[model samples]
Target: MKYNEFLPITLEEMKARGWERADFIVITGDAYIDHPSFGAAVISRTLESAGYKVGIISQPNWRNVGDFKKLGKPKYGFLITAGNIDSMVNHYTVSKRRREKDYYSPGGKMGLRPDRASIVYCNMVKQAYKGVPIIIGGIEASLRRFAHYDYWSDKVRRSILFDSEADLLVFGMGEHQILEIAESLKNGLDIQYMHHIAGTCYKSDTKENLYHFIELPSYETIATDKIAYARAFKIQYEEQDAVRGKVLVQPHGNSYIVQNPPAMPLSEVELDRIYSLPYARKVHPIYEKDGGVPAIEEVKHSIISSRGCFGSCSFCALTFHQGRVIQSRSHTSILEEAEKIVKSEDFKGYIHDVGGPTANFRNIACEKQKKEGTCKNKQCLYPHPCRNLNVDHGEYLDLLRKLRKIKGVKKVFVRSGLRYDYIISDPKDTFLKELCEHHISGQLKVAPEHISPKVLDLMGKPRREVYDKFVDKYYKINQSLGKEQYLVPYLMSSHPGSDLKAAVEMAEYLRDIRYYPEQVQDFYPTPGTLSTCMFYTGLDPRNMKPVYVPKDRDEKAMQRALLQFKNPKNYELVKKALILAGRKDLIGFGPKALIKPLGKERQNIREVKYSNKKPATKNRNSSKNTKKR
Candidate 1:
């Protein structure tokens, strides 16, 4: 098969492929982009590689069953996903306001998919064809496999398995899980009875067959009680590993949502096959008239060198979705992809990226993780690097060196989130030096998140000292190389444990650094993150200690304003925050003052400066929850 041979989307195409009906129809909430970066595309292509006829139904109109029926019923079932991102996150902003652009949609248009898209599509599929097996996967379903707190609804909702009509929910990467389920179905086994598959959740009536599992608080209890919710989240977070992870059963009213132990990470050769599939590497040509997918621009030239993160930031859902074990592609596979990219007509000499979930995590954190999986209790890098952590970036460094040597590739950038602490732990400066010389252009972006110890601890990030160490080392390396590269540190605001005082402390750090961020990542409490769990429950799931959560709208805005306190528009909010924190001393005309003394003349001057300019357009497509961070 060639790149031009896209999978069957329309029935005529299915007939052209000489198939009476598809064995499985993938219904996604995104415009069909047949690229490996897309989760839907990968799953569909993997099925096709296994000799299964897979059809795609991308972003069918929820109001009309006819749009879904267009693909017709499948022989096996329908594999549904809400695209690459969670539906609610794609639809709304941190403030619960509707976002104007959907990066995953055609031409960055919004409303291409409905909110709670997986459930909505399942309902529509049922209306279109009853009694057909419905299997739900993707970020939306994976993260919501348990009874999670829905940020959009501001209520604890039943597990997506219970709410949706999906017979099975593939919670992690579905390559293995989907194949197993498809084989079982092909052998005439019923979907309901196939609950033994790893990395999947199925609803069960009785607990008779559920053995060696831990039962969580019922959905009703966690919905009302915060403590119970925290407790449940703690248990769920701990048992996400493939090895030594037991079966987890959570009661949802009368039924139970049983999640088996996570599936094992694929080996290098197996992972290579996933990217080796004949992906068309473009948005389906049908959408060309609407302008190509805005999301593709960021990643079209990028290569995924690795998957999953052991960095284990509390605000990230990688733990729940991808697990902590890092799975990477072989260097040979990546080089092959680079050659193909170089051959493209649009090749710009620069390869956009050569990394993944965490760019530096090309291998396991330690040799122990290979067989035992990630430590259930200890983090690989947090307050400090684990004594057992094998912090070597040599393999990743070599991969980059090879890519940069590619004939047509001018530069290879590592544009993904990298753990500075990991770089700090490495004894050698070779990788850091090479990175400065070849990888970056003008500046490198890193997430310091906050400067407060208390907040950093809650976020599972290294202490401020570690970031300081990195900053010194980064600049020193650049200086030695005669390069003047800068660091664009990513910061977040209003996370749990970020009281007004802590927010003020972060402001003081910004003043010292002399960096004013244009965009501030205010903690968006999406489901399946420890930080989100803390936001909803006001208790740390790890310790059950009370965490001060800034829930008030005014306080949240004040915290955000404090980050960019240098902005003239934030004067009022900054003044209010400083006063509330009893740091009224900061509200004066001293050198340390965040804002100038409030006066009618000064205010008028500021207002004129602000109002004279055109309104700054927000890149609604550039969401803070982006995987890049």
Candidate 2:
């Protein structure tokens, strides 16, 4: 079979391919790169493989209708996305400042796409082609498919299905939903009547068609009442599963947004076929003159061995989007992809990465999850590992071993975020041993996020002690393997439940380790995260208990500064943070001081340090040592 070189992007290309119109036109906020890593490419290709002619319109000019009308009109419908990353996230910094560069754009150019791109592009399509079906998905639409807190807007907004005025919203990985939607459209089914498809959301005037679906709080109620909003998020979080997941519905005035349950996780053979799909595997030649798309470089030589993550960090929307179960490509499929990478001119005898969201998770967390679904009440690795969690890493190790053995492949690195909790949960040391010896170049990236127990629990991360144990094991493995390596722990600040005291505690821990974080991640409350729910409502959705959120600009900055206290620029912020948290003792030039007392106060400053000590404010989570399982 002749494979697709690149889906037509222009009228000339369309004519050259002998196509008058495409079956589907994929509108993306990112520059067109026909690689599987880009969602638009995968969705478009998935349609193309099913005998549908799919076209790509990437980073179109939203101010006018010409770019939207470039493909004339799709024979079936339009598939729109805000690219791999959310548009708002792509546009703004955590401090709500406009970003100077967009990785998905050509030459890392800024402002190629508008803010709230999914909404903007959908409206543009409607204006360009009247009455054509527009289906929105990708991370932006998937996470905001329900009434969600929009940080950029600083308010709870209605689902994208309504906001975009699109006919359908495909949440999660849309390969399944896209295929079904394409086939239905080809069979002459109306987009409105195509509401029964799983992993898709549609707006309806009545709830009569939905069966066994839970009704969440109305948009009006959630927008006004924080408790109701928290409650709504709680229900949404618990019900996001493929197996045993029920349909969910939320109301907005006269209509209901009905979300069908997520599609079943792809099987091993099915996932393998998707990665093996004919992809151009490079930025389109159109983008080459503009220094190419910056996003493709990271993924060019990499192999996505799996999809879906069960790590379920509170700040992560993977739980609400990809769901908890793991779906991986087969070993044969991965090796085949690796062999192709080896043949490339720029290979350099190195396989850059071989993993998914969480590199180590290659299967379902437990036997029960395979049939009954992830427990709505329990987590696989938070609080503590479940008694039934399957912790074997044998299969993943073997896959790595085979990739290492592949000809012309010198190194196979696991660069994705590896769950440290999952690592220590295993009784065997072989995975860690092999990891240090064969996988990493030097430093492995892990996300402990914070060392404060209260913040860790609220972030749905494992306890501080879990990170400690993992660190010890990591170093020990490196020492035994006769390799010199380091650990780069990804930490966050200003998350809910992280008060000044917690931030100070984190700073002190970093001091103890003699490691200072060069870059601090200030929590940005994006849509559909449990932590974002808490950030917006000031209450943990799990229990409706108040959480002290660091929302003030000064407090957020101070928290971020405390993490990098050793930086000379953060001296004043760290000193102020110490005084506010009643940790004035940490301000002097003593052995444990976070910062030296300013100016002449350095003269035996211990005597005057207590003068500025203010009583520490109330900590809502200080007494709550354990996660609420």
**CA lDDT, every prediction?**
0.91, 0.89
Error of 1 at 138 (Å): 0.0
Put down candidate 2 lDDT per residue, 1-629, tens digits, no spaces.
12247888888888888998888999999998888898998888788778898889999999999999998898999999999999999988998788999989999999899998999999999999888999999999999999998888788899889989999999999989999998898899999899889999999999876678899999999999999999989988998988888888999999999989899899998888788888988888887779988998899999998888888899988998888899999999998888889998788988889888999999888888888988998888878888988899999999999999988888999998799898898899999999999889889889999988898889888888888999999998899878899999999999999999999999999999999889889998889899999999999989888999989999988999999999999888888888889999997667898887765676446334433444352244334422431
Query: For all candidates, what are the clash counts?
Result: 0, 0
User: Model 1: which ten-residue window has the lowest total lDDT?
Assistant: 617-626
* Model 1: per-residue Cα lDDT over 401-459, one tens digit each: 89989998888888998889999999999988998899999999999999899999999
lDDT of 2 at 22: 88
- Model 2: weakest 10-residue lDDT segment is 617-626
Candidate 2 local lDDT, residue 363 = 85
After superposition, the stretches of candidate 2 with alpha carbons farther than 4 Å from their true spots are 1-4, 604-629
Write down the TM-score of every candidate. 0.95, 0.95
